[model samples]
Target: MQVAQATEVRKNWSSFFDQVVHDKPQAVRRNRDTALFLSKTHMEEILSQYRFTLEYEIEEDGYYSGGLKEIDICWSEPSLEELKQTIAKDLVEYAKTYMDNFALYHNAPNRRDHFPYVMHVLMKDNIQEVVELIDADWERT
Candidate 1:
């Protein structure tokens, strides 16, 4: 994790590409501004630790209901399979909405911590990958 001056990196930006790929993410600074430049895959790997749980319940009417409470997103469907698909679809929509207004979502008191989870959702190449994150836990009474 090397820290380099922002100007130097900018001046020799081409050389930094290899370093960013081979080495741990580097820190760059310009005056009071400092930030890490990391690969998208690396960022995803790092954020992978922040996972959301999938919860659901069988309603009296036989509808399956619930979703990731951490992000306040949920869905209801007639079957468990449809529920999973709905959950995945809803998650992707939520992620897109969150990213569309990143500053707003990131600044929100309740949603501030949702960044990692939202990123996790967006990282998935498809809905199946996102659906796999959910454990098959269910509440039935």
Candidate 2:
């Protein structure tokens, strides 16, 4: 990866684009790595090398219990925004079903190591609360 200053990149983006095209990866630094620019082919290859796992717990109405679901995402070189959007879409689908039993099983607060997982049981009648909770967690991640 080639390191380029943010100011330099901003001042001459066409040159930076050419550098990224030739070098494959260029780290744009502004005190820290603000962004990494890469050729489309190179970016896809990098993304294809990793397997991302997303795990979450939800209530099951039939079992009156909680279950952990693990989702494995294999990205074929999508942009960061695209990856986040895909994950958010998948999470919403799973969240809607699991959250139906939220009131049935998790009607009280439980001690969790994670601060955000420590939820207070409030609105028992609405599924919107669960949706909001899931959305909030998604955003945080």
Candidate 3:
């Protein structure tokens, strides 16, 4: 509710930075556009509650197709390792694509809430980490 206009924010950039980085998120308004500035740490912590799971189905001939719970991306592979690796690569690619067309994607109603999940993938070091993050720890018999 504490929204600062664009001009006031620009004039007091340092104070805003200090408040956002050290204290909490700050809201800013420019024209009709409004945005919130929050730290990456806070974002990660907030998104931590959301689990990145995968849903899979086995084809008649033994092939498997799976999709990420957080994003709509899917992959098909002959084996579990290959499937995980493929999905990881796909997630990395999708995250980059999301950032590349941020304005368009963010404005989309279906994808607006996906920013947290996309950032989770984007913050990863590599595809391997992504694989591990979404890796199933199922204890199957």
Candidate 4:
């Protein structure tokens, strides 16, 4: 293993990568061991110890208000009962999804223009084989 200062590695990243590809693993550090630069084959071997899967999902549209959309507020004085009802309604909506679940996110809209998405998780066990096939495709590209 070779040791390299993090700043030195950053300044000559291409040469560092070339060294890692042809020579040996390089340990890059600042105050402590920060990262390791390893050969592709070594990286594959390390990754082989754990299982990985390629995930595919279809994004389905859901309700979303783009951040630019704003609600207009009425400044008219309201009775105490009306104020209580408004607060209650807001509390219900917050408990249903707003408080914990709903958050702002942006992505390319679906076929029918909409922002929110429903993600489906898909996994395959043959990750290494798939990665090699993708790598071949990448080389051609």
Best by lDDT: 1
Model 3 lDDT per residue over 113-138, tens place: 87887888877777887887685533
lDDT of 1 by residue, 1-141 (tens): 567999999999988977787776889999998898887779888977876676889998988888875777788899888887887788889889999999999999998988888888888899898887666568655
Q: What TM-score fits each model? A: 0.87, 0.35, 0.69, 0.33
Native RMSD of candidate 2 (Å): 15.8
> Which lDDT value does model 2 have at 61?
31
Which one wins by TM-score: 2 or 3? Answer: 3
Write model 4 residue lDDT over 1-141, tens digit each, in one string: 557898898899999998899887889989875788788676665544332121212223321111101111111113323323343333233333322343432232221121111110011123233222111001111
Better of 2 and 4 by TM-score: 2
Worst lDDT run of 10 residues, candidate 3, spans 132-141
lDDT of 4 at 108: 21
Q: What does candidate 2's lDDT look like per residue over 1-141, in tens digits?
A: 557789988899998898789866888889854787778667545434222233322223321111122333222213333444455444454434335666643553441221122121122124343233332112122
Candidate 1 least-lDDT 10 residues: 132-141
Ranking by TM-score: 1, 3, 2, 4
